[model samples]
Target: MLKFIKGNLESIDGVAVYPIISLLIFFIFFAALFWWVFTAKKDHIKEVSNIPLELSENETNDKNDLPL
Candidate 1:
């Protein structure tokens, strides 16, 4: 199976460029992600991290106010 696939790929023109292009794309995406993670504002990060807790608190408050 591997021999068959390799034989097919070897016949195609510019096939070698595909691997390099894919690698560059993968590298750039992670590089951008790393940069964003490092440069993101701490206050914004804290607010986003608290979103689930805020939602749960709101839900509890809403339930308590509901007519029993």
Candidate 2:
């Protein structure tokens, strides 16, 4: 595996630098996303989380129409 990687690295121009730069960009993107998710309004997360559990008008109507 090491020999294969070395052969490919030698054949490709700036391949090593590309991986480093790609990893840096990925790290920055995830860091920003994590910060935003953890620090942004808590209420927004609460509202979104509750959506699946809250019954909609159509769902309530369906329940009401069910025979006892």
Candidate 3:
């Protein structure tokens, strides 16, 4: 399977550019994610981190009732 793909790509002109572009896209995505993590407000991060806890608390409290 690997050889088949390599053979097909080798026959295409400028196939190398595809990998470069993909790498650039992947790098940019992670870079943006890292920047967001660093720049996000402390309160926002704390709220997001407690999402699972909040859901569990609500479920426990609402177990005997139905939400509208």
Candidate 4:
């Protein structure tokens, strides 16, 4: 199966460039993500991290307020 796929890919012109482009895109995406994470504000990070806890608390409060 691997040989069959590689054989077909070998026939395509400029196939080498595709791998290079894909690698560059992958690297750039992670690089940008790392940059954003490093530059993000502490307040914003804390708020975002607490989103799940806040949601659960709100749901609990809502349930308590409902007619039993």
Candidate 5:
């Protein structure tokens, strides 16, 4: 496995740089997403969080209750 990786690395130009660049891009994307989620307006986050509960409650109310 080590030999295969070394051979492939030698065959590709700037392959080592690609991984570092990709990692940096991924980190930046997640950092921005985290900042947005945490720093966004309170009302916006509240609205988003309520969506699931609202849908589930509506569905549950529509279903007929079972007898004990």
Candidate 6:
């Protein structure tokens, strides 16, 4: 099965660049995610952590407000 798939892929023109492009996209996505997680503010994290509890306050104050 693996050999069959490889044979099919190798026959296609410009197929080699697909793997390189996909790997670059995957690496960039994770790199950006890591950067965001490390650089995020503690205050923003704290506020986000309390999101569930904040929902109740909104429920009592403005029932008509959007859920999020």
List TM-score per model, in order.
Answer: 0.84, 0.78, 0.72, 0.80, 0.68, 0.72
Ranking by lDDT: 1, 4, 2, 6, 3, 5
Kindly list the per-residue Cα lDDT of model 5 for residues 1-68, writing each as its tens digit: 99998997899877789889999999999999999988899999899899876757657766747554
Name the TM-score of candidate 6.
0.72
Residue 25 CA displacement from its true place in model 5, Å: 1.0
RMSD of each: 2.5, 1.7, 4.7, 2.7, 2.7, 5.9
Task: Return the clash pairs for model 6, or none.
Answer: none
Tell me the tens digit of each residue's lDDT in model 1 across 1-68. Answer: 99999999999999999999999999999999999999999999999999876657778899999998
N/CA/C clash count, model 6: 0
Model 4 scores a TM of 0.80
lDDT of each: 0.95, 0.92, 0.90, 0.94, 0.85, 0.90
Q: C-alpha displacement of 14 in model 3, angstroms?
A: 1.4
Residue pairs with colliding backbones in model 1 are none
- Across 1-68, the per-residue lDDT of candidate 3 in tens digits comes to 99999999899999999889999999999999999989999999899899876657667778858766
Judging by TM-score, tell me the better candidate of 1 and 6. 1
After aligning candidate 5 to the native by TM-score, how far in Å is the CA of 42 from where it should be? 0.8
The C-alpha stretches of model 1 lying farther than 4 A from their native spots are 56-58, 65-68
Candidate 1: worst-modelled 10 consecutive residues by lDDT: 51-60
- Model 6 weakest lDDT span, ten residues long: 52-61
Candidates sorted on TM-score, descending: 1, 4, 2, 3, 6, 5
Per-residue lDDT, model 3, residue 7, is: 98
**Best candidate per lDDT, number?**
1
Worst 10 residues of 2 by lDDT: 7-16
lDDT of 2 by residue, 1-68 (tens): 99998987899877779889999999999999999988989899899999999999999999999999
